[model samples]
Target: MSADDTDFLAQRFEAHRGHLRAVAHRMLGSAAEAEDAVQEAWFRVSRSDTDRVDNLGGWLTTVVGRVCLDMLRSRKSRAEEPLDSTPHGAPPSPAHAAPADPEQDALLADSVGAALLVVLDTLTPAERLAFVLHDLFAVPYEEVAAVVDRTPAAARQLASRARRRVRGADVPEDDRVRRRRHREIVDAFLAAARNGDFEGLLDVLDPDVVVRSEAGVTTGAAAVARGASAFGSAALTARPTPVSRHALVDGAVGVAVLVDGRVERALRFAFVRDRIAVIDIVTDPERVARLDIAPV
Candidate 1:
């Protein structure tokens, strides 16, 4: 590519990095993977003869979409893990370790939530690419088909199937609403649990509340009690420690469960009115490293 062409490509890549990352992250469910996909797309775009392209933004989007789809398909064949294996219960990592740039942070904070990303993971690779490109990015079906290497009709079907999963009976509207109510319930749950107030815990918990740990490490309300009680007892027995700050996880309020300055857990809450609906406590250490947690 000529110097002018190189400069043009650089400008275009910078402009669309946020858009490309959003699409990739939605497909891959990991910020690290998404960044790699976008980098690969940029590599491809840099080598291509951009002078021949009529629309730069569209071309970049198509390349990023293709790269992300390839990653998704490769992941599916390699690992078949259940969804909801990890709950959103950990402190955010230090800001310097955050996987996304400032722009990406804003886009994710506003557009994608933790629950939505979980839903996207359930989709097949083709369906995920088609849905994200066509529905979320507003790419034309013809272009999306080209990126996914599918017939336009087939791509449409993939997107339709993915949409159905997102809008299915399993994902109730109430669950989405629960994201908004999660923070309040989490705060109340922690307070009551810390105080050993069984009545307080019962007041916040739904009659049939379920608390599942990462990879099914623990389950059910009783299990939740056992696990939480262990932590609470530690807090009471240990020397006075600084409290961790709380922040929104994909817009849902959550507590950053910290211990001795390192983020030990992230406790994301789900609520039905004033009652606790579900408490997802994510304890995946690798996943915890990606969040933007402020230091103690």
Candidate 2:
């Protein structure tokens, strides 16, 4: 291939760079490692003959996935500290080293992703790849099978098994029930916000609900509904990150708002009779600084 051909290929790869990084991030659970995997994928792509490849984006995604799979396997072989060597929501010990990246710390400390990543850490490399690709990325089982060296049917099964694990059946019987309930409320709130379902928001929220943030606190269902609506509007336009993660907020069931791979805010909930009564918004800077590991 000519120099022009290599330059053109590099440009094409750049178009898929963000997505490739996201894939690796979710797979490796470290932004730094994810970027390294993406860089490796670019090198591999540059060397390979893509004359027969139809979808350049899809091809690059598969390459990145394969690269990340290898990294995860290598980490496993090294028996490195589990990503959450600390408890899922535990604060770091002062005697230990602090995180290398504060924003990345927010990803785990303030987002549902922290607990989810802990669960993903338990899966085999092939299972993680199969699930992250097919389930998260919507890659076909046939394509995923190629990455994991399994049949399409087997790859689908791998994802299913991984999915069950991700959902936490192995958790203690008591903990599982509590997490399930938290998941329900958080899911409902997110759905309501995304769909502009005011009634739905009111349904789960107590009539005397209070939403407290650094900005100020809004009390009562009507006031709370209006505040949520404004937030929903901004989310729909500004970032479109209506996704919330179930996390242990200050030791209770809470949800965190994830935007562009960072935790924008976390809400610690106080429930009364199965209805959301108090929502303490764990805003960044303070939340990131403290871990608000403080119990409610």
Give the whole-model CA lDDT for all candidates, comma-separated.
Answer: 0.64, 0.69
Tell me the number of clashing residue pairs for each predicted model.
9, 0
Candidate 1 lDDT by residue in tens digits, 54-149: 888898889888887777777767773333212244222112133567665554534555666788878888888888787555587899989888
TM-score to native of every candidate shown? 0.51, 0.52
Q: What is the C-alpha RMSD of each candidate to the true structure, in Å?
A: 18.5, 15.4
Using lDDT as the measure, the top candidate is 2
| TM-score: model 2 vs. ground truth | 0.52
Report the alpha-carbon TM-score of model 1 versus the true structure.
0.51
lDDT string for model 2 (1-296, tens) is 68788777767777787668668887888866765676677667767899899999898998998888878888856865433333333322221242345564344333335565778889999988988886556588899998998899898889878876776435655445655765687678767876778898898898988877777878998877766766774632235644556675534567666678566667677555567767777565655444323221
Worst-scoring 10-residue span by lDDT in model 1? 85-94
